[model samples]
Target chain A: MVDIVIPPLGEVEEVRVVRWLHEVGDEVQAGEAVAEVECEKTTFVIEAPVGGRLFAILVPEGRVAAPGEVIGKIAERAGGR
Target chain B: MREVFWIPLGRVGYREVLERQRRLHELRRLNKVPDLVLSLEHNPVITLGRSADPRHILADPLALEAAGVEVVTVERGGDVTYHGPGQLVLYPILNLRGWQRSIKWYIRALEEVMLKVAASYGIQAKRVPSRPGIWVGNEKLGAVGVYVRGWITMHGLALNVDLVPDGFRWIVPCGIHGAGTTSIATLVGREISMAEVSARVRAAFAEVFGVQVRVRDPTGLEVMAR
Candidate 1:
């Protein structure tokens, strides 16, 4: 399992998860945007860290998340499956 | 010094410039191009952002159509706002990885750029807490709204220079009720050319962002967009 952590957003400590593009069990590719977060009237896309199935979504839409927070998880397949 | 391409697109339609911004955004995201600053005046339009309240648009469809104003819903943050001739709009398509990654910092930087430009004209502008725009007392002088996908910014600040009253009469101007909008020409009590304000904007942008701006012809970029 790989943790989908929110990246450091400069001096902003908190961001609200505006929406999730993918749902649990959805296959996601690394570098693909999976969630959108907004802070101070600026919206930013949070991309996937690795290619895998979206295992969980800990942060729902309109929920606030902090930098380095585990917002979701990805389940990596074995043997490149 | 980091170099940024500054493209001055003289009067353009709102949708046309938006499409061009998207194209440049993709190139910047893929590392095919460096950061770019697109400056232009939009032909009368009202843009509603993601969290915009439709009721803020006071103008009815017939009235808007009669005035030749187009309404568009954009994928940026903030509420409803107007753009038209004489309002200098700056769309800086920049990757946050090369600058500060925080959206708060980025917005502040944009506000600073506007403030600097206003100051150049001897007009004092400020940011009101909880009211994300450049204001003179209670009257707004400039507005800032942005969309950052993959940390590459789009849809940026708009400074009222010699604003046409019709556009603002139709909307609440960023949803701020009762607070009127002012312009550089209004404050100075004289006519100000778009070229004069555009030059100020470029200087302030370069100073605030700490990047060397190189003005480029929009011909090549328009061809690429095609």
Candidate 2:
């Protein structure tokens, strides 16, 4: 489970989280971006499709997301999440 | 001159529709979309077919993203697919070595744009003369994974416009595992709306390249929306 969406014209009419790269146990790696959205104009960094360990965020930090909205999740090092 | 821009990108998100088709293949290597760039994505991706074999993408890739969907590793060849939200991803990034780079005539002009959008719902599609896309009674609605790079052609074709035939029952599309992948509201029964099959595939991609389609909005075209 690795989201962090809002792409397509992803100029973010809303996107304001900016932290939590890996914690719940930390491992994340596949592509790694974890979380760093800001869509209002630009600030993207949302990676980590698989490397595992981050648990969840749903939308922590500053708040204000929505576009393809997903925010966070990545707990799969030996498999998926 | 020769415009057919329609980037409605409504449900995009498959890694930003593969990064806007790699930024329109660098705007068709700097020609800046106009030679062609009609798009209409519907995110929910899972692509993996270059004659796929990634162990049959047997899911459980974390249950396919805990069902959020977005597991792309594309090059557009064909073997795995699942472009959700009513599926309709087209990306004629154009330049088939001057229209002769021929990936089988660009997949028979994407099987004549699904045989004229399944004959405008009258249903009667064809082009299985060896297969690539477009079919009717024999199922296989639309699906034509592509990719060229030097010949220039980014991923295009996937008109199961409004899919849900059990969401293609989990991969095996173009690789045809046990046959099944039909659409156009299930072979013309009803309910068609991917902007009416993307205006019948922008008039069948300008009538199979005979050319003459000048709609707008490739981001508000201004010399091909550069």
On a 0 to 100 scale, what is the lDDT of residue B84 in model 2? Answer: 81
Candidate 1 stretches with Cα past 4 Å from truth are A78-81, B221-226
lDDT of candidate 1 over A1-81, digit per residue (tens): 888888887877888887799999999988788988777777778888888899999999979999889999989766323
* DockQ for candidate 2: 0.04
| lDDT over C-alpha atoms for residue B218 of model 1 | 77
Per-residue lDDT tens digits for candidate 2, residues B61-140, read 78767777766666454566677878777777777655564355667777787788778778787776555677775677
- Residue by residue across A1-81, what tens digits does model 2's lDDT show? 666454433122554564555656677777655665432112344567677777777787767776677777666768643
Tens digit per residue, CA lDDT, model 1, B10-117: 999999998888888888777777788999999999999866789999989898999889999987877799999989999999998888877878889999999998
Model 1 clashing residue pairs (backbone): none
Candidate 2, residue A41: the lDDT equals 17
Candidate 1 docks at the CAPRI level of medium
**TM-score per candidate, chains pooled:** 0.91, 0.32
Model 2, runs deviating above 4 Å? A1-81, B1-24, B28-53, B57-91, B94-112, B117-123, B126-138, B144-153, B158-171, B174-177, B180-203, B207-226
